[model samples]
Target chain A: MTGRVIVITSGKGGVGKTTTSANIGTALAKAGYKVVLIDTDLGLRNLDLLLGLENRIVYTIVDVIEERCKLKQALVKDKKNPNLSLLAAAQTRDKTAVNAEQLKSICDTLKEENDFVLVDCPAGIEQGFQNAVAGASEAIVVTTPEMSAIRDADRIIGLLEAKEEITSYKLLLNRVRPSLIKSNEMMSVDDVVEILSCPLVGIIPEDTGIITSTNKGEPIVNDEAALAGKAYRNVAQRILGEEVPFLDLDEPKGFMAKIKNAFAKLKAKV
Target chain B: MEKGFVENGFIIDLSDAKNTTQLVFELSSVMEHPEVKRKNVCLKLGALDLKQSQLLSIKALIESMDANLAFIDTDSEQTEASAVSLGIIVSEISDNLEPSIVCSAAEEVKDEEVVIKTECEVVEEDKTVEVHADLNSNANPIETAEGIEDIYDEQSTQELSEIIPAEHFEANFEALAESEGLIKAEEASKYILLDTGDVLPEGAEENDTNTETLPTLYINQTLRSGQTVSYEGNILIIGDAHPGSEIVAGGDITVWGILGGIAHAGSLGNVTSKVRALKLNAIQLRIAGLYARRNDTLNVPYVQKTNEFTPEEAQIEDGKIVIYKKLRRD
Candidate 1:
């Protein structure tokens, strides 16, 4: 069964690209589909650390491209998920170590055995981004609810449009604070979706659990109690062509806000 | 009954050990203490008979912990033969050497000279005590339990140094200063060592060709991330090796500043080659074919600078990269 190649990227750094790749790949694996997560950010790879498989990465993608080891040997199996494995990038090498063709060939070879091959692209649209996007036919552009992140996402989407290999691309709005949006201090989800002019794949709310989970080397998706984890799982469901609705992140918090939210909902109905 | 106090040396009494495994376990557990990082260790092995390989592993285990196995106090004749073959100092603990050892099994393997233990216990210099007794049958046999107590009763610590053979110091490096007092570069990494390019290809045989005879390459500039310097011989850098940089040398690598990158020495498998730095904070320390990544707990994210630098050295011994914190220059 050939897998769909999806590159998870953000033009700006610190936009949760790696986290999105990790959580979505894990969510797919938990759904009983074999998934491969490839980290193409050489010299600054962190996908393995997020999955807690850093120690198990003996050989990296560079080893595969250099032919020092076979591609199968370099695939580090996730500690908890048997169906999910990672192709880690070499932390010591830069983007020039493995070019676009080599990564594309690796992704091509890996797709034959898995249901989804998710490429975690490094920030920027330079050689690293081109190399990451080379392996995949679809893309998920991760953007935070800020002007700078949206601007970068637009640049990434424009780049994706020029490449014929990227048949489709979707946007993932990350770190959306509902209270901030309610107070007009942050951008609303609809505003980002409208500005990017791209279809939405996921909207992950800002959760304190993400920090602890990242440090613990466990993905937030594994924690069922976490709101962000549930949101990521819904994102995975939507990726599987299921019509999962976006999470209602704008829940009222205090008693006064609850009364105001009820009036706003009624006003929307009216 | 581990009563052993020699200056910069520890006398471990493993007489309580029932078997070889337990002895090594207890020895390694005690070696974990900061005090045992670099010191001479004398083992008191009881009646358990150990083969040559087992004895070698025990020696390697001690050496891996940065301690040298100075000698073994054994009761088994087979053990004594194994120790002698391995060039390990085989000493018969005098019945009344230290006021600490209270055992009956020790007096059985007495040698001609009651020299080793007396000197090891009294030497004031750190791990400089070397007592060499010529392998001779215990000429004077005493069947009575208390018969040998009076032979060395009057022998003081100063007079015991007289019997230390002068030739033994250079005879063997079985238990010497080279490996003693080393802090282990603690890493639980896999054994696989990766090569970047044609740089030290895999499955190569180890040749301990002296590194001093090889040519040297010196760089006075700082190495940033992704930059690499590989040399056929020794490589000397006067500046810091940043976190992502790599330094590969056929022989030795000496960095005058912080080494926060990966430093591989004896890259082609010269086990004697070493990696030294003013501050050895390398992400990974590799020697010969061995590699040790810094434990994540000690892995700091950013490069730190300070005026005071406690230089450290890493070298391969007993198939492990043991780091040594060098003495400060006043």
Candidate 2:
């Protein structure tokens, strides 16, 4: 069966591009759909570490492009999922080793067997970003509520619109904290969506468990109790043509907050 | 025709060099030898053409090593024209000429042509890297290997086979600033070896060619990310090697500052070559056929510019890569 080729990118660094790719790819595999995560960050690769498959990598994408190994040989199977595999990037090599055409050919070949092929792009709009977006039919623009992130996302969307291959594009708003937004300290989710003027796929709440999961080399989505994990799972379902509502992150917990909420609603009616 | 006589000179034969990179790399590696510091260098460029800019760079590179370009012999018409325009002499040495050494492999030289001989050739041309080294008219380095090893007494290979299999190793690195006693056991387990078997190049024979005998390439600049420095002999860096950078040497690698990249020592299969840095923070350490990586718990991104440096050294011992942490001063 043919697979859907999607590229997850962020124009700025440390905006959760690799983390999103690992979590969504795992969520899809857990749903029984075969997925392949291709890390296009050549010299500064972190996807393999996030998936806890660093020690198992014998060959990388550069080896495949250089004809030192077959494409299948370079694909390292995930530790938990049989259907999910990783085509890791060479940590010792740079972006100049693989050109856009070679990455396109690799994506073309990978989409034939897998149900979803997610490309984890490096930061910046230079050669690395161009190589990552060369063969994708869909794009996931990951951004935070900060002004710098929205500005870069807008620029990326403009570039994606110019490419004929990108049939659709959606925005993934990450690291959202409801308390900060309510206190007027951070940007609201609606402000980000309005600024970018792009359709939203999912909103990932700010969770402390993400840091622990990253250090443990386990994706946050695997933690069933994490709000960010549930949010990422909703995103995977939405990718599969299902309608999943956004999480109401502003809803306050605790007994005193429930009474306060009732009084606030009654006062609004008057 | 008889050529003008010159003293204290060397004829570097680059006739087999396939490209400019190979030519420059081979030339730089040999030129850094202390013996060739003041010697004039004569290059033999084969059929390969050289642009004026490329020739200028090569000339500048040779001058950087405190050597002079005496002349060059080239077969390519384009190279001759380029050398003539750059005011470089393009002429061949006649058979009647007398010098202390001759590297030209011609059918005409029949008499006592060479008083000096090549001290290199242990490095096989695997993935392209083989060149005749700088010649000295006086000393044979092979006989002096033992004496040179004595100079590096603290850095000696002390029972290398026993260092790896041991549960704990006594800290043996004597600090250059102060010689302190043994301290911690956890300091020696910095890198964990990989299980990949027999990673040596095809048809590569294991040998302990004295790394002291090989020439060194001294680099004085900070190596940024994505940059690589590969040499056929020992390499000494005066600055830091940033993450994402790679330094591949055919012999020992020494860095005066932090080494945060991948270092491949003895790339041609000389297991005795060592990798040492002011701060041994390499992401991956490779010695000859063995490979090891930093512990995952200590894999945090390298940052912070601190003045404190605990110099460490890594070498192949007992078929496993072992690290020795220098003692810290109280």
Off by over 4 Å in 1: A30-32, A48-58, A79-82, A91-97, A208-218, A222-225, A252-270, B1-180, B183-204, B220-222, B238-240, B255-258, B277-281, B295-312, B320-330
Clashing residue pairs in candidate 2 are none
Q: State which candidate has the highest DockQ.
A: 1
Clashing pairs in 1: B38-B181
Tens-place lDDT digits, model 1, residues B1-330: 343444445667787789888988888877776556687787888898999999999999999999888789899999999999999998855434322221111343233113333333333222222222322243222111222122223322223113232133222221322433344443343122332222346876789987767777767678987688997778877678987678999888888789988788998888888888878877677787776666655545455665457677777767666776654412
Give lDDT tens digits, candidate 2, residues B80-190. 998999999887743232222223321122221221111111111111111223333452212101122122333333332121211111122222313433333363357
Listed in order, each prediction's TM-score against the native is 0.60, 0.61
Q: Candidate 1, residues A115-136: lDDT per residue as tens digits?
A: 9999999999999999999989
lDDT values, one for every candidate: 0.77, 0.77
